[model samples]
Every structure is written in structure tokens, then in C-alpha cells.
Target: MKYVIKTQECGYLFKNGILKKILFAGKYRILSMSGWELKITEMTGKVDTKGLPTELLMEQPDFVSRVVRVQIPDDCIGFHLVNGVYKQVIMEGEALYWNVFEKNEIRLVNVTGTEMTEAQVPAMYRHLIPSRLYKRLSVGEGETGLLYIDGRFEKQLSSGTYFYWIYAHEVSMKLYSLKVQQLEISGQEILTSDKVGVRLNILCSYRITRPLELVQKTDNVANLLYTRIQLLAREYIGGFRLDELLAQKEEIGRFLMKQIQGVQEEYCVEILNTGIKDIILPGEIRDIMNTVLVAEKKAQANVIMRREEVASTRSLLNTAKLMEENKVLYRLKELEYLERICDRVGSISLNGAGSVLEQLAALALPKG
Candidate 1:
């Protein structure tokens, strides 16, 4: 039999079901045996050995000169480049490509005890890499991230995406909010100086100023701040009487800011503002206050009624004195009384009287 291999093709010569040699771009006369064969393949791309031993294939210096061999280590990755351009990513394994026509290169990178940097592998090939081979972290806006490798602090990351290979190291992260956040300490019970129990709800706004210092000082910054505020509130409340605490509810908030000045610095936080939301009194105290208010209002009403009566009496006495000083005024008062009496009586018949006007005047006068 006669076999012809093209200039851009390779021929694998097999004799009795075994590969004998690799033929490249040549013409040869092969015997027509039952188990003899010549497999022709294109040399434009990867060379497929089809389970043939690479050592046996490399024995031919002519075959070795025409192709390139890549042995990717188990802990390393290979980036295949053709004609000075990225073509494919080669995982852990062995690969072979023809170098006769175009230039070929396999960039080997060790993925042990190191992160995946953009310089090591270009950003354009991020999607080409396998997802399981690397770890990804996204730090959103108004937040900062702390990166740790093998339980040791490494560095801080701003708001962006980061990639690291999980080869032989453990990767962990901690996020801290930079914006102001509210903390509510609701229904906290305390005793006043007068032994009065009160429940208070407090709110405070804060933000993390130094995330690294906070992490080093305390395991949880929020918890530390909460405890400080709670203790200060209790101490301030315990010093004031019940009446004073109720009168100066806003004073408690101001006291908190002054007392927590040192603590805020230690915790690496900025205290924006603090306030007392609600002050809950006991049922017994509330009832007593309601009763006292009702009694006070009743007393005020009585005093106002007595004042009005005294004013009315004084006005009457002044009018009587004016009438006594002048007979004309006395006559006018009598006529005024008669006019009022006539309005009430529809009809009247006088038998013992000098004239109707004189008799009416006499009747208007007081009997005493």
C-alpha cells in the first residue's frame, strides 16, 4: 500500500496494532498487512497522540523538532500562546502542539502560597480560568474589607472586586461599615435615686473610623460601644431623683456623650449623636401623677370662682353709693325697676293710688 502525508499533516505509522513511528509531510510505501495502518491528522492545531507514549514519540528528533511539548505540574497552570497571542488555558496535564508553522509558548505559573495577581494572568483571561481554582470577594460601597490568610492579617481592601487562589492557604475576610448606623438600647431598666424603677429606650448614631484599630482592640466594636453606653446611662440615672430625671430627660443624652469620650476613642468609633427615645414610668407612679393633676386643677377652679364673686360684690356696692349721692340717680333706678316689673306683668289694675306712675314708683321702692 502507498500512503501520502500532506505538508500540513502528520502520519502515525502503526504495525501489528502498535505505533511504530510518527511521519511528517512525506510519502512512503507501506505494506498491505491485516494489522498495518497509517493514521493521517492535521498539524495546524494540537497534536493528538491517542494514548501513544510521549517518550516513544520523542525518540524521533525530526518529530521532536516539528512540535512543542508542555508538562503542566499538578500545582501549576499553563497559558497557551500562539503567534505571541493568548489562545487557550492549559490545566494540570501534558499537552503537545506543532511549532513548525506558528510560534507556540506555554506560560507556567505556580499556584502555591501566592495570590492570583492581574500581572501573573491578564485581566482579559479572568473568565477563561476555572471558578473552583480561585476565590472572589466583592467589597461594596460604604464598606471596607480586611483580608486574612491562614488566620493572619494581610491587608485592607477598598470597595472593589479581588481574586485569590485557594491553593494551600486559607482565605478569610471581615467587612466594616463606614457610614453612620443607629444602635437601639430599648427597654433598659434602672433605679433612680429615690428608688423609683424606670425603663428607658436610647438611640445613638455611630460609624467606624479606624477599622484596623477596632479589630485589634476588640473582637466586636458594636458590642463594646453598647456596653459602655448602657453603663453610663445607668450611672447617670441612678444619681438623679425620679422628678429630676423626668424633668431633665434630654440631659441624660448629653451626659452620655461626655462620659463616652474616652471609650469612643478606645473603640475607634465616632459618636455622631445620642438621644433618649422614651421614658417609661411604673403604673403606680403614673396613677399618682394623674391624681395630683386632677386635684391641682380643681383647686385652681375654686380660686377663680371666689375671685369672680368678690368682683361682682364690689361692683354692686359702687352702684349703691352712686345712687345714694344723687336723688336724680335714685329716681332713675326706681324707673328702671318699674320697667322691668312691667315687662313681666301682662295686665294690672291699681285701686289705691294717686296716679299710675306714682303708684308704680312706690311699688318699685324696697319694702324695708
Candidate 2:
């Protein structure tokens, strides 16, 4: 029997149900007892051997096409997972041939190992690997990262890049700052020794002295530290009256620093500074203080004025006593008063015209 072969079709010659040779792009005549299998494939390709069985096609590598061939370069590796299970790992710079005809799959995995272990291979297929195979942890600057595996602390890393593989145990990281940090505890209202309610704003600057103790010993170190600071500030403020606190705020700062010293060791934090940022009195109290300040200033002004007036009066009395003790000085004073009177009168008229000059001189200082 004769079969008509198209130019785009490849013919497989079989005798007694066994493949013998391949036919390409031509008409072919077959014997009546033999059979012919024709398949259409893209000629432009390396002749897609995807539909062909790899076990049988690999035997004739020369005639096979690059349908499912995976090439692993020198810097990479290839993994082949068969039937959803890891079967083989190809090392650097290797080529693997495969086809889709079999019920198997092959994927390429890039890793760094001369040979991969069976235990290290993921049980899943290649497509779902990257998300399940490994994990990454970034320890930023000024932060210390703590690595934990299966909820157990492993090691602490400082400001760097880290990578880990996840197969059986769960992996995670906790970061704590190693730099100086500031916390502002604001809007706290406490009672003073004078039973006056005053609002306080506090600022604290500190750093992590012991990272391991801060992270492992306490679950919420920041909250605990804040609580202690707040309590200490209140206790210290309660010991002083409003007037005393207002007089010397530096004293409150000193007391606050003293109180926070013990908190540093307890929470593993170095208390660099602690101070009261602002002291806000109640409206009524602020008004009362203002009134008191104004009244005290007025009393001081009145005292200064009375002192100046008394000093002036005593000086005048002493000057009068000196003038009475000396007659010539008294006569000089009479002439001084006459000069003052003449300065006020711009034009003075003398009654005695002929004796005006002599009379004026005599009236100015008589017989002195």
C-alpha cells in the first residue's frame, strides 16, 4: 500500500509494529504488511521532540530536538522533579533532555552545591518552590536582629543581611534598636505636696545597654520601662509643693535622674537623661499665682519709693542745718534765691531810676 505524505509532515516507517526509520517532507510508499505513522511538527524548530518519549529519544540524541532540554550554566544548577517528587539534581554546566510524552515533569533550580542531598530537596514540585524553600531577614542599621527557629531563640545578628532555608522548622526574626532613643511621656496629671493638681510632660533619653536581656527577659520592655518612669516621676513630683517645684525645676530633673537609675538595670536600658519638659498648672492655680506675683511686685515698688522719699527729706534737713550754722552761707543762699526769681521775670522795672543799679546790687545781696 502507498500513503501520500505532505511536505509539513514527518513519516515514521514501522515494520511488524516496530519503528524503523523517519521520513521527512516527501511522498513515501509502504509495503502492505508494514505500517506508517505520520506526525506534523514545526520544521523551524530544533525539531520538537516534546511528543516523543525521552527514554527512547535519548538513545538517538543526534536526531532528537530541543523541545524540553534544560541547560544549566556554570553558575547555576538544574533540578528534575518527577511526578511531583525530586528525582535528580544536575550539577553546573550540564544539559538534560526531556519530553512531555511521559507523565513526568522537569524544572530548573539554581543553587550552589556540587551535589544536592535528597533530604535538602523540597518535596513539592519546582513551580511552588521559591516561596517555600527559603526565607530572608534584613537587619537594618542601628538594629540587632534575633533569629528564632521553631519559636526558640538562636542567635543575634547586628545590622546585616541574612538568609535561611525553611524545610521543617519555622523561622522568624525580632529586631531591637541599639541606638540612643527618646521617649516622651506627656500629659500626666499628678498631685503635689500642697494638694495642687499639676500636669507634667516628661522626656527620657536612653539606649539599650543589654540587648539580650531587653529582648529575652521581658516581653514588652518599652511598655515596662515607660510604666516605671511614669511611676517614678509621679512619686518624685508628689514630694514637692508647687512653689518649690516652680522655684527650682533643676531639682526635679536631678530627682528624676536619680529615680530612673534603678529602672536602667531592671529593664536593661541605659538612662542617659530624664527631665520634666513642662509643668502646666490648673487654670485657677495659674491665675492665683499670677495675682500673687503682681501683688508682690507692687509691694516691692512701694518700698523702693518710700526709701527714696525718706532719703531726700533727710538730705534737705541736713542742708538746712548747715546753712543756719554759717551766716555767709545763708546770705549766699538769699542771693541764690534772688537769682532764681530774676530768671523767671524776663523784664524787671526799677522804681528809683537814678539809683536803679546800686539798689539792684544791694537787693541781690544786702550788706554781705
Candidate 3:
């Protein structure tokens, strides 16, 4: 029988012959001999057995046996052996894989799947484990969720899935957004309560930019915003004693707008609008204000009357001092008075020059 031997590495082929001989009686033996030597023994014909050579029948060594090192990209699909056997399967998308074998010790083998685009790669990787509690949250525009991995809270994550280590108690969270819409204050759309009327509508929205772990820390931001708005409204609007905001409508509107803007800045939220719907005032307060205004006016009038009286008294005193300083001026004043009295009375009666002298003497004397 003729056989062939093939080496897997060098592909070297060798042919040999197997001879069966009867030694002694009833004993048969098989011996493998070189084909060239057997041919010189005068074999009648070549006998062939369809089988793999003895050297080629040995088992192939494992691909990882001589692997010295390996480098895998982040987004590899799967890896396989050079002998056409699959090794590792990557479940997630956008990953890389590689296998490095020792030089000359084993044949180096590489297996790879299809590649993906850079734009499709996730900014961060999030691992999810089964049987673990996770907080599901919805985020709007300008809002974020707080996630605690182990015990530490992370800042931000691009939009994607995330996982946290399981603990005896699951983490808690409050979901909220950072975008704030200003309330609309218009007469047509005023919000009316039992004591006050407000015209404002708040609209908020947010978008997620990272893989976020939802926990109790996430609740702080939203709570802060709500608390701030409520407190501001109470402090600014409720503190006003004026039942009717319309009386000082313009002033109140401006003040409220400023307060809303301040709150927005504090929370890092965008202020959409701040509006004043209506001014509310109690009837009793309005009447009281009117009465107080009337009383003020009366007091002002009294002050003016007293001032006029003082001015008249001062003028009379000045005139008297000037008359005393000049005797001729006093005589002139007396003559003028007589002349005015004579014009009104049809005639002036006096006992000649004696009567005139007596009148002049009387006028000159100081009256007790």
C-alpha cells in the first residue's frame, strides 16, 4: 500500500509504502518503508490508500496558545480565529477587536466585522445589568436628572442608557427641566383667584445631552426652581396691601417682571416671559385712601391760610415803622385819608381853622 504525508506548515509532501509479510506460519506483520526503497524491491504495481499522511493527522494547536498581546478598538463587532473558528461576539455596536500571536510560534490570525461611521458612535458607554433597580425619568428642555453611580453623582451624559451598581436601597431622584417660561399677564388671559388676579403662563422644555443616572440628587434642581417661583410670587405680589394692582398697574408690572428675571438668573433658566393680568384691590381700602387724600388737602389749605395771615401782619408792622421814622410821611398819610373820606361823604364839616387845628392835634396824639 502506498501513502502520502503532507506537512501543514511547509506543505511538504512525502510518499511511502506499507508492506505486509508472513513471518513464520499463521503470523502476519505490516511494515512502513520508504517508497523509493520499496520500488527497488521489484513491486509489481503501485498500491494507493486514500488517507491523510501521518504527520498531517496531528491536532492543530489552539489559536490563543501563542497570543502575546491584543488591542481592540472601542466599537468592534466580533472576533474569530485564523483556522475559521469564531471566538468572541460583541453584543454592543461600535466596538473593535484584535488578536496578537507570538512570532513564529503560532500563525497570527485576525477576524473582524463590518465597520460603522464616526457619527454613529456613542459619546459614552452605559452598562445595564439584569435584576437591578433603575430609575426611569423623563427630561424636558433645559432640565436634567441626577444619577448616583455607587455613591457619587455624575454631572452630565449624552443622550443614552446608563446603569448603576445595585445597592441594598435603590437611589431616588426628582425629574425637572431648566428652561423657564415667563407668565403672560394680559387682561384676556388673567388667572383669577379669590383674593388676587394674575396674568401669566409658564411653559418649560428641555433636551438630554448625556447618559444620566437618576437619583435623589436630580430632584434638587427642579425643587429649587418651583420653590423660588412660589416664594417670589408670594413675597412680591402677596405682600402688596393694595387690593387693586391696577391702581399702580404699571409699577407693579415692572416690579414683577424684574423679580421673575432675577429668579430665572438664579436658577440658570431662560426666562420666556413675565406678565401681569389684572390689578385687584379691596373696596374698603380704596375708600380709605380717598378719605386720607381729602384730609391731607384740608391740612394743606390750613397751612396756606396761616401763611397769608403772617404776611399781612408783617406788612402792617413795616408800614407803621416807616411812618414813625418820618413825621412828614405821617402828615401826608393823614391828608390822603381825609381826602378819600371827603370824596365819599358829600361834604366835610369843621369849625373853621380852630376845628382844623383840633383835628390835626387829635391825629398827632398817640391813642391810648
Provide the overall lDDT of each model, using Cα atoms, as 2-decimal numbers: 0.85, 0.69, 0.41
Colliding pairs, model 2 = none
User: 173 in model 1: Cα distance from truth in Å?
Assistant: 2.4
User: What is the lDDT, from 0 to 100, of the residue 133 in candidate 2?
Assistant: 51
Candidate 3 local lDDT, 191-285, one digit each (tens): 33345434433222222222242232243444654455555555665544344444665675566556656655445455444445444434675
Give stretches of model 2 more than 4 Å off: 1-18, 21-34, 38-47, 61-129, 297-368
Best-fitting candidate, measured by lDDT?
1
What digit string (tens of lDDT, one per residue) describes model 2 on residues 1-368? 55666654455555665556655666666665545554445433233544655455545543455235555765444666555656565654534433333323445544443223345455443334454455667898988987887788888888876556564457888888889988888999999999999999888888987887777688777677678879987877788888898887888888888888776887898888888899999999989989999999999999999999999999999989999999778778877866887898786666755444456666667574
Sort order, lDDT high to low: 1, 2, 3
Ten contiguous residues with the weakest lDDT in model 1: 348-357
Question: What is the alpha-carbon lDDT for the whole of candidate 3?
Answer: 0.41
Query: Between 2 and 3, whose TM-score is larger?
Result: 2
The ten-residue window of minimal lDDT in model 3 covers: 40-49
Model 1 pairs whose backbones collide: none
| Superposed Cα RMSD, model 2 | 10.2
Candidate no. 3 TM-score:
0.30
Q: Give lDDT: candidate 1, residue 26.
A: 77
